[model samples]
Target: MDSSVSSLIRTSYLEQPSAEQAVHPSVYSKRKRLIDIAGALVGLGITAILTVPIAIAMQFDSPGPIFYSQVRCGLRGKPFRIWKFRSMVVDADQKKHLVRNQAQGHIFKNENDPRITRVGRFLRRTSLDELPQFWNVLMGEMSLVGTRPPTPDEVQKYDSHHFERLKVKPGMTGEWQAKGRSNVKDFEDIVRMDIDYQRQWSILYDLYLIFRTIAVVFAGQGAY
Candidate 1:
């Protein structure tokens, strides 16, 4: 039908380059190096001024590294180290498989995960633990706002449709984080939202999500 042809044309047009292409590079195709540098510097400064004390407390609360780093899938399936303030025991990864899966989508979070340490519990509930990801943002491995990064295993499990998420840089906070986070209990719904982000990505949308994230962080709502 003519309507079907029009729909196809619209989809094709969206897939092509647009005016935003020169200023804002494709998330996977080009590196927005400036964003990485400036955002990271500011983030690092804020983290040092505000989060270092908390990091010190986390170290004292447990006998392990102050920070935790894990290999996460980045743009175009590239692997990058995602940093976070350590909120679990040294053996957390080894014990993860033993715990019941409580996450929605490819994520593996739990509302009452036993692996969380006392300080970790607070950090997670308050989202302070994720402050370290500003470094990832600085390192060009992530963005301040984008789709949540997936693990290698999760990426491997993804269907072809899920690969679209890699078209943009991963983010420290995203639609998922701002919307429901742990409250979203269905994996398919998570994928749907991620796809929706790609279809609707805009600077305004990112800004709106960022403000919403601030509210969510302040309220500490639905976060484990």
Candidate 2:
């Protein structure tokens, strides 16, 4: 983790949970981990191939680091640094106040955010910026198919019911990403879909979501 993200880190000592506290079956399934590992290996391979070209475009478009890392709360409110190909001005975080957030509830977003660089816009629209997250999946902090990770600030706003979304590991794509990501502006809807995923989850369902995500990506639908 970078020095900037280190300060926001929340490392905790987790204890064995009681039967009632158990999460979804997918959370601890060995088959799921194997799938995650296989998918991450392929994703990282793509990331590796694109790294050089993406870095060049970023530097040419705006002078800054090639990658961006930020603290995000994972399963059970544990914090980890989420990585992405830099898609904004180097000081975008510092200039956050200059931009107005259009999304409602806990998250922040702007369709026309001025902080995004020219190359960054393309990366985000293509979902290429998320390629690096495969590493998070491989490291066991995330999954190939699951809920979206919440930022520390976002998690702080979560009530008891809201915390249910975090019961599963965050994913590269899930219900929202596969279906309504582009048009779903409300956070509550995301929460509902997340809980629904947990209820309807199965290995086959995960594979379906993964395929749907690929189609969504190719169609260039959804994503800020």
Candidate 3:
């Protein structure tokens, strides 16, 4: 949580137009924060209820920590630890060199990555691995709706426009997640949608996206 973000993200973003002008009003809205808190409380309750079963399954599938935490850039490129249910082998990061990246730019994805345990595969497909992120939201490190948090390494390669996406806190689900996440692998397309979301944002719109995310998760559409 005390981690410093890549200088690349902060240095360049500082040179852009003032955040007050570039960032959306929703970012500062008390009403939005209230919703995020309410949603996070409910989400954490669900996660608590599901944790036992998920933990058992994960332990049986692979002997490792039940949760995974990684540092990700948040608003204005502030670095914070993002949490998730464990979705891969214990040494997944160490073995990353063994997998081939299929997505373009800094984002990395391999639907068939061998490091994922059998239970991990299902967790990823259902997005159950993300349940732990409610804690992040509860801690105010993430929003209920905003851009996906990019890793510090990923931010190091970002262009000027990409910095705009970091003006608000990262989210548990956002434009990319509401749309089909698997199909939207191109980093540029994700950046466009994120910025568009900021432009189109309203408190009502955020609620709509949250419900849409539930539908997408149930449908199991475009997850890997």
- Best candidate per lDDT, number? 3
Q: Give me candidate 3's TM-score against the actual structure.
A: 0.94
Count of backbone collisions within predicted model 2: 1
What is the Cα-based lDDT of residue 70 in candidate 3?
A: 97
The models' CA-based lDDT, in order, is 0.74, 0.85, 0.87
TM-scores for every predicted model: 0.82, 0.91, 0.94
Question: Which residue runs of candidate 2 sit more than 4 Å off their true CA positions?
Answer: 1-21
> Against the hidden true structure, what lDDT does model 1 obtain?
0.74
* Per-residue lDDT of candidate 2, residues 1-224 (tens digit): 34444333332212323432456678889999999999999999999999999999888999889999998878776788899999999999999999998888887879999999999999998999999999999999999999989887776566557777777999999999999875787899889999999999999999999999999989999876
In angstroms, the error of model 1 at 199 is: 1.4
Over the stretch 77-124, how does candidate 1's per-residue lDDT look in tens digits?
667789998889889999998888876667786777788899998888
**What shift in Å separates residue 32 of candidate 3 from its native position after superposition?**
0.8
List the pairs of residues colliding in candidate 3.
none
Which stretches of model 3 miss by more than 4 angstroms?
A: 1-8, 19-22
Question: Regarding lDDT, does 2 or 3 come out ahead?
Answer: 3
Q: Alpha carbon lDDT of residue 217, candidate 2?
A: 89
Instruction: Choose 2 or 3, whichever is better by TM-score.
Output: 3
- Over 9-102, each residue of candidate 3 has an lDDT whose tens digit, in order, gives 5776677778532666777999999999999999999999999999999999998899999989888887888999999999999999999999
Candidate 1 ranges with C-alpha deviation above 4 Å: 1-37
